[model samples]
Target chain A: MSALLLHALGIVLVTAAMTFVTRSAPFVLFGKKRGTPPIVLFLGTYLPPAILAMLVVYGLKDVRLLAYPYGLPELIGVATVVGLHVWKRNYLLSIFVGTAAYMVAVQWVFQGTL
Target chain B: MMKTVRAAFLTTLPVMTGYLAVGVAFGLLLQKSGYGVAWAALSSVLVYAGSMQFVLVGLLADGSGFVAVAMVTLFVNLRHFFYGLSFIDTFRAMGRRRPYMIFALTDETYSILCTAKPPEDVDGKAYFFWIALLDQSYWVAGSIAGSLAGSLIPFDMTGLGFAMTALFLVLLVEQWEAFRTHEPVFVGLASALGAVLVFGRGNLLLPALVTIVVVLLLMKKRLTREAYAPPTPPAPADGPEAGGAP
Candidate 1:
């Protein structure tokens, strides 16, 4: 779609043109609407979270649990994420801890050297 | 204006890992598919989709016809139509930058705009415009890197695609905490599940979005007038770029 339509030069120019037309110009179509469309407002709020959950599930799709020597890395990471999210209610902390656990698992647990 | 930029930065910072993972994946995939830096920059600049761009690479590989390509691209990117619809009030007043703002509509940019609250001294229009700019900068940078480095980087980079999902996870948790309403969450889940069941995994987002719209319409009576819309004001900031000489 966009890839084929835009080459290096074509991409830059078309993109810039679209932006120029959409944002740089004055109020046009969606602007000054009598009211926010009912459906738009509803979708705006919930779409981020639902799509996000789907993404999480998608990432974990086909992940092999028992194939790992101890299943320690993923187990620790997911548990830590759920735990930290529930415990501290901090998004950043959950990601950090889970990611760190995965790193450690790959580096040490898999090797059984650390 | 500065406050808006600062806020956008703060908000976008939380999603960097997601952006980094997805951006890098797009770049790698683009380069691998014979797209150059120009292509990367162009789409990142124009299309401005976080994950949809990645999917576009496959479409390009298939050699779909121009009309098909455009139609499919538009359909796939139709979620963006909602993005524009929601922010109409804010971007409508951008004066000069309004057009670019509309064109540069990315999910990250929209998220920034959706959550943004103009500070006392800042102009909402300018703030809205700048948020879109900063978000585009990140995408453009990723595109440039992907296209430029396409020739150099080797080995499979498929793992980077996980970034899209990772980011969605981060946002999910963030919004869950910020808002009081939960109906939207239920609707989205039900829709996504419906999409997965109906379209299978290959084309889930569209069905999911459709499901969302249908449910909201069906539940319109119960769900109306509950969500918070940001305040709107019409005035240029007290001269652009505060804190300069008289």
Candidate 2:
């Protein structure tokens, strides 16, 4: 069921506000004069890799290993993305090829009787 | 301004593809859930976080209470708080455009702004603003197209979602190459795997992030010391700023 217009608006607005606040919080809290605390700077300098790694995992969180084709499709898909990116260093090529590979795997190769 | 815009467009060209595909998926899913194109457009225009927008599809479909939805959105977007810390000075320097920069600091944009600098002749504000604007436009255009075409599309989209994962992986690889220290990367991977085993898929992200934080804090002496050390070699003398005009 679709949410009521009012509820949808409220949810969307709240999400927007919360997101805006979080993104701007660092700047707002630190201000321009005092500068960012060293620990905060440390996190700022270093958190990107960790966050990106977490995002990579988060992206594939739903892939099921217990299923018939298992997570092979996912594994292969990731390998293609990683391999192609490592080889080419082209972001667009890697993502397009990796996605195309996954689409083929699930749609045709790993197609389970539904 | 034109030159800066062109360079920004070039810089954001990679994100353009990812946003379009993911945005289409979002629109299709939102339409499938009974919301109209207007709703899809509004959500894309407003919420704007790619992963959170995808999650919002479910939350919207479920007709969840505002409080619950708000909490989930906060949790999903908590990392953004970290993203801003790095850009605080740069964004503050942008004066009038600072607010939009903050609002548009999505994961991909943050990644781009972290490493890419404009050519010496290009205005940094113009470059940064155009990047953010162009990226958002791609999302809006893609989502609107998908919502409009959602009902007419006939093909299976079974594994198309992996584009997002692929995007993240590509970014991870780039970050890995950029960083000299492997501690954060390893900590993130290990923490995520631990979370997967302990919390399973549904509840993994927050715990994984917390674990990374805890471990990073415990090892702060090493990480911070190494991170801020003065450059051993000469800094890149040929950085984009020095590369002059396009």
Model 2 residue B48 CA deviation (Å) reads: 1.3
For every candidate in turn, the CA RMSD to the true structure comes to: 7.4, 4.9
TM-score of the A-chain for all models: 0.59, 0.84
The digit string of per-residue lDDT tens for model 2 on A1-114 reads: 434878877877888888887788888887466454666665666777887888788888877778777888888889999999999987778888998998888888887822
What do the candidate models score in CA lDDT, each in turn? 0.57, 0.78
Candidate 1 lDDT, tens digit per residue, B5-41?
Answer: 7755655654565565566668878888876666677
Per-residue accuracy of model 1 over A1-114 as CA lDDT, tens digit each:
455454434433433344334332223543556654545554444455444445455455445555655456556666766667767865567676666666666565676422
Ten contiguous residues minimizing lDDT sum, candidate 2 chain B: B237-246
Can you list each candidate's DockQ? Answer: 0.24, 0.52
Q: How far off is residue A76 in model 2, in Å? A: 2.8
